[model samples]
Target: MPTIIMTKWPVKLDGSVRSKAMAFLQKLSHDDTTPGLHVEPIGGSADDRVRTGRVDQFWRAVMFRLDGNNERHYVIHGVWPHDDAITVARSVSLTVNPINGLPQIEAASPSVASAGATAPAPSALSSESAPAAISPAGSEPAAPSTPAQPAPPSEASPAPAPSEPLLVRLGRTRTELTDRLGLSADIADHALSAPNQDAITELAARHEGWIGMALIGLAVGESIESIVESLELDQPHPSSGSQEADLLEALRRPAARAQFSFIEDQEELRQVIDHGDFGAWRVFLHPMQRRYVEKSYSGPFRLSGGAGTGKTVVLVHRARALARRNPQARIVLTTFTTNLAGALRDGLAQLDARVPQVTGLGDEGIYVAGVDALASAVIRAAGADVGDAVRAVLGEDRSQPNGRTTSAGWREVLDGASTSLPPEIAHESFLAAEYALVVLPNRVTSEAGYRRVRRPGRGLALDRAKRDAVWSLIAAYRAQNRVEGTLDFAEAAAVAAAWLETAGSLADHVLVDEGQDLSPAHWQLLRAVVGDGPDDLFIAEDSHQRIYGPRTVLSRYGIKVVGRSQRLTLNYRTTAQNLRYAMSILEGADYVDLEEQPESTGYRSARSGPAPTIVPADSLSAELDEVAKQVGNWVSAGTEPSSIAVLAGDRFHCERLARGLAERGVAAAHVEREQPPKDRVAVMTMHRAKGTEFAKVVLADTGATSAERDRLESLDGSARADTELRRRSLTYVAATRARDELAVIQREGRRA
Candidate 1:
């Protein structure tokens, strides 16, 4: 069957024209010869290689038909009016750049000598000989007349000369761009021509391929190696097939996928039409992210990056990829919370609704749920076999242990434990960490096991006597929890892991998002659910976004990711201004990742915007009023109400902000676990907004953080440090969620 590579450039079209274009794509994908498509050759193009298909009476979709031995591939350039479509065809340049051997498709201004119009007649394979003038990178118009073809892309600017938005300060030589970095001569010259960093960013924004990614990555100080690994340009494809077939293969390259969407079948074409242009464009994956999604690891692989770095995006795509590759594989896609899992499920559906989804674990297809949900599923799957684990948490009765998630349960148990021991050994917080990090994860049921357990990442150490004391308290907590019918999420995971280890469950692959927040029991459960093997565990974590738990070492639970880790440093969700402010929140904190490696949260953003605004209002009440006005202004300026948010420190504060906005007649909804409705401004705590983002954020200080900080200050040693780390991370998480704008509301000297 013939393939269709839809150009994903920013095309603007009216509802009518867009509808017609969708119909044209559907018709073309099913049968190019369909009468209404009018897949006729365009005039003044060499060999009649470029053609125009009828989108409607006035608009036409221009494309290039590449013929293989037994197949044909049609690449739709854009939709334009007849006269404009003809000119646009003349402006189209599809070539495999000689430097990298990767296919390139772009549209130039009609005034510019388009390579397609001037090059040799035609080739069945690569458009390698075509050489369009390359200009310094810059942004371009979204579309033409009537939600039209993207305005002749700015990539078609004047030929590279002294370079605008120049990158002279970076001192990147042509050899580095070409031989070393794999950029085409034209693209290298374009980067060299730029006058400043913004030019590089502008060019990158317009190109949608290596040139844009490379320049922006370099502009933001990413190493050439880092950029190359993420782009996956280093992978060599030995060319043995017919030139035309090779061209098709080239589109499958990691680099080309960043720009083109190859429609697999009619259903995908339907999805393309339904998503329209921008929505489909949103699903494009960063090359490195795609790399993680597709690569097979010996055991567990970890992908780490700062907030908004697309870790979750990678996990979602990986789930689909793994499912497609292993049809019968039992794959579990999980995260720390049920809401995040729901978000992942929705994202997967949006990505490709065709991917199979199953409700329970071990069945074919994918099982999506929170980590605890996964644990519960494992427990439920091995119902009778899971009695031992149930007993571990529920004591003798082995009945359902249901109460608060053990946070309150731990306090209750601590309130009744012997108080004669040292504060560190007797504290509820200490016991919680010890149980989660050392005891629960290790399945330490007795004092001997607790004493022997290796607490690698724990900030404090316990002697034999201290261990005995802690074990006694843990015994009491479990006994009390069994009476109260209460079980912690971590305890459930521990029990589930133990059951899986003994019974050997059926999960083949597990993809975890927000891997850092998962407790020790969760890690052990994941390890057992999918015992270490080829492509077993794929975790996406950002320690800088570790808003909940302390640092975890995956090695302890046999979920090692030491040598199999990839770090993404580019922030895709925020502007440089917001990212900088977010990183500043973790200035002095050094984070050791799950592998015990010192991790840096330093990241560079592709886009630049206004520096984060600090709204140091006189008081919390005034702050709320100012925030309402700012959100009102943003909504008035055309930002979606849901895209505008006022993030507070807690639920109480979030509700207060929502009421404050409502009183001011700015519609706001306080969201907890559910998604914020599109018609209302999202008033949410910073914690609830962790996996989500906003276009404009008012990070209000209701003075909620001060009390926690004051309480943590009284904590000694590692407790104080861990609490402070999470506090900063929470603030960072909130600040970074702002894609374009961040306004901080502070009444005193503290971060909101």
Candidate 2:
């Protein structure tokens, strides 16, 4: 069997041509010299290295037969028409540079000279040289640089007229660039010898994180100091002793091979060639992301980063990697919400279609589901009814106002408890906080245990009498719930945890995503389902994006992640300006991970975009009017309304905005766990905005009024602090969802 490398050209070919190329490659992989393919060499090319093979009457594939030392491999460059294929084979040059020991491709045509001089040799500048001026098989080199000569006054700030149609030649020898900048020889050679600066510039622009390295400065016209700074940040103090070895290693790196791939598995090759998705998983991943997916862990591992940092990407790949490594391993991948779980499941199908589907938890190749859903399944599998718990906690009908239940609704339970307490006792908010943050998390089964525990972060000190009084109220509520056969979500998780302790582990590996938003009981349940061993558990979370559930400490739940953790810094989704605006919303708020580690202070994005628009109107109608106008303008400008999300502070506002938009003749649909129709505008609350993103976001009236703030301030100190923190976090999460543009619409003079 011979090694077959696939370049990006086939992916760009017409569908019929691509199919032909894939079929031809499949045959060539089994036998290098497959008969009837009519592989013929071009006579004019140096060394006759390039060859053309017949795909059919109309299509032809161009390939480079690399033969050196004992190694022989074939690189399929492209598929095109017969004439185009032959022309490409004749004009292209393929060679393995002895200095770097990596294969190089270039056009045989002369370099497009800048100013007066010709470009230098490959050995003169960088290790990786740019290919020649000959265009790709079916394409043509961009119309020559031809610096703008002059322009009429109608154009503002048009390109400056070149003094003599060209300035001093931009080209330099690899040796000259390397000696002057003190950079590695390979990098220098690549800058000086490459013929297509435009191609390199485009790559740099697309992958900003790799701008400083990869000889990006040469293409983007950056100074040496700036390139050095970027390289330093990418890999501070690169310490390889052998430049040639470093270049070889770099060639094999995941980041370097992101744009090209050599397929070894015939099945995987078929998937890519059939779908033309060459950049899918296994290729095109950032080096850091690949590390998170493949690194071996001694215990549980956690990958934390902000939204769009590829945390979920890592989780999906890790699960597939585990399943592939251990064919019989029972792997479970879960997230906090059902929406994200669905997205993960879809991603898995694309990543590795061969992964077998299990019936449910405890019976599978890989299980993908929401944590709550998994808990319910686990409880049912144990012959325990989870609905009984829910009915017991809420009424038999779960009759709560607005068809909802929340910790804030605990005021009703506090009312029952407050009757027995002194007049000086804090309001229902404080008691609710005491129950949720401290009492339930610690699982205090007795009055004595509750009284002995020190209340951390709780400002109101309680005497023995006060503590007993609070306990009596809690006991009463629990007794009613028990008699009613009801269990709240939190209690259901707790019950699941208790059952798991007695039932033993459910799977070999349990992966948790969006872990920061899970409740304490949820964590406890997760802890119980996986044994303490290598790869027992994996978590992907970001505290800053935590929008729901109580803040939990993993150590208390026996899920320690102190030593096994990685933080991803590069953000692939949100633009730099949008990220900064999102960060501003979280300003002054401190967030810590489950292990109590402060977040990375250096968190930043390299992708830059326009600053968010902040609109302030004097009245509610005025604000809505502005929002509608902006939304209409965006739609007129060719932005898909589905790609634009209009989020409000609460559900009521969301409904109001939707109605207003409809009245104005704009089609709007309320967004939920499931997505809205493609043609309709999406309207949702900030809380519902979790685990989602949009290309454009319109945050209409997110801030509360002075009266609302006053009411919040009236709550107990602990309740007020927690409420405010969660609110701020919600806004931050919403703001960060905008990838390209953000607009914050609010009533003028309203208190935030």
Candidate 3:
């Protein structure tokens, strides 16, 4: 049976007592018959501050373990007052046995034992220090009392042998250590499992001052064990065929798997860095970086801003992010026009190279295409029947006028709808059917009712109930023709939606740029394509530049405008004075508010710098000469000749302006219902300037009066509407063309 030991020592003793204790331990270790002793300091000064105050003062207690033949030693740990008298008394109670070489448990004094046997225990003693005693059997007498002297070297014991396994120590405090490192357990585990011994040593060294490192070393050992278990090996000496088979199996389980996993983790870390997680440490990033990350994770989002507000910049970032998130999937990027599409691709390429540190995005990553391109691709992919249907429809409508079709045309087509309708009527009916298919609620209906249903804003204006009935008939017609591969743009969207609804799947996400320019028909198509999935959808647009037309269906299409829905209001392209003058001309009474003008160096208008000159020319030739002289002054000032445009109020005026300017060596080309000019001064109608800008705009026919004015004013409903459209068109053109200067020359006799 193992024997037990107990000891007590004064905490306030001088350096002599410490020397005595050390000597006793040293003697015991050197003694042949004694086993090793382990001395562990239980709780020491917690920090440098505590250590300073307690350095001179002795500790109140010490616990030590000893081993001997058929005997074992265990220290009974205790806490007591720092008083010298009490500590001395407690130390006197300590005893040691020569035979077992262990400290015997201290016993109660005779007075206390007799008092306890005769009467109830005193409450004061019980509350202060509970009297503890040990069995008298096999116990040794106390050391003889003597004048205090330095402890003898013969009393000390040898140092204890190392016993605890490293792995066990690590397992005990894994959570505590990992928490301090600000790391997840999985990551910590991976780090600890580093294959190289040097790496393991360095990791262990990082925790040198920590008590937890003792356990961490063991964890490292466990990681090594796991790694070893994962490795596969074959028999040392196998037959020729067996050896060949083993070699083949080894090749199938190449070591690259571990290497690849590590590389992937490293790449994810790089992603975090590019996402501006490390921006706080850096000075700057390309403008697209912030826009990209914000729009990518901003959930289903919408953006609205003025022109030059970086809406397109944000769109490029979103496309890059989407491509990164779905590398293997085809990403479709669509814009309203071919020019815009080309510009977007160029912008994306520049962004990739400029911000190459951003992960998962490359030059070839995004597939930038236009809406027409996407539709054509989808139609072709649907099969030969769909292709033939599209071609036949296009061929039949060869003579159809360009631009948005009129409501009157829609009425006639709906009135004469049959299987053998004209190609133009068929095209109109197809769009109408598609709109009904997507926007109408699902239901059944009769043929008579279907014919009565007219498209929105068409037919004789009717009361609420009659209009509702028309809508119902439209819905019924749509329900009857819900066939796949039979939809035009609107119907295609509805069909895609139907596939999602019935077939139960959708693309990972959808992204739309320049969303504000999308028409009601285009929006219907987008809704059908997106369906009801959690796939991320990012939409960006500038409402002020909705130059496509004035119909908005964004809200009805399920995209929610969020955040401020505006960019920083400051304009970077134009001087504050120029912006103020431009806004004054363009804004009028509809202006809600204007951004405060920023201080700026005055803008230098191109040579012949005159505030817009409004000359009333007596003849077209006279006006052409004045315009040519102004153009000549700009050209002499180093402005490119192509930077100038001569805008007229009507197509006929544009033709005459072109011919007159040509006579003056201006080389003006009319931008009417014709292909764009290659290298000549643009003589465009004011309406055609809706999405264009020019450095110097000459309003040739601004002096319109009488019948010409009446004819021009009759095209739109209200005078205010026509004025606002023309003003916005001018603003768009002027703002875009003039990076540095703007000139607007009005033909004086062309009445406003």
The best candidate in terms of lDDT: 1
Order the numbered candidates by TM-score, best leading: 1, 2, 3
Q: Worst 10-residue stretch by lDDT in candidate 2?
A: 134-143
Superposing all C-alpha atoms, what RMSD in Å does each candidate have to the true structure?
A: 7.3, 9.4, 32.5
- Counted clashes in each candidate structure: 17, 26, 22
Scored against the true structure, residue 722 in model 1 reaches a CA lDDT of: 83
TM-score of 3: 0.45
- lDDT per residue as tens, model 1, 1-752: 56888755344565566767888888887788878778888666643568888887878887888897587889776666667667767766676655566677644642422321122222221212111110111000011111111112222123444433445666668887888766656767777787655556655655555666777777776777877766766644677656667677777777777666688888888876775553253346667766777888998899888876777777777888988897988899888988778878877776688889898678899889998787777767776666776656434544563333545766787777665667755777777888887777666676776777788757777777777877888888877766666567887787888778788867899899998898878888888888768999998888877887767888877877778898877666676767777777788887778887888866777765656766567766888788987777777766667667788888987888888889999999999877677789888888888767666788886344566666665565788778777878888888877766777777665544
Cα lDDT tens digits for candidate 3, 680-729: 77777665654343444555555446665555554323333523544464
User: TM-score of every model?
Assistant: 0.87, 0.75, 0.45
Off by over 4 Å in 2: 1-203, 206-251, 264-266, 273-278, 384-409, 415-417, 420-433, 457-460
Candidate 2 lDDT by residue in tens digits, 1-752: 66676654421444455567778888777776777688789888654767888888877778877553344556676666676666667876544333223334555544411111122222212222111111111001111111111211321122443342110246344553444344345445444544443334323333212322244455435455544443332331243564433333444545444334567578877766655543344344555677778887878898888867777778777888999899888898998888778777866775667887575788769988888787777777656344443333222322221121344445656655546565434466565557666766676667898899877757778889889888877676666555444555666666667667777878899888899889777887888788888898999888887777666678877887887888776565565667777777777877778787776534555344555777778987887787788788777766667777898888888888998898877788877767655787789988777666666788887787888788787776656766787888888878876766778886876766
- Segments of candidate 3 deviating more than 4 angstroms: 1-289, 292-295, 324-326, 353-365, 384-461, 464-510, 531-535, 562-564, 588-619, 645-656, 668-735, 748-752
Model 3: lDDT to the true structure: 0.38
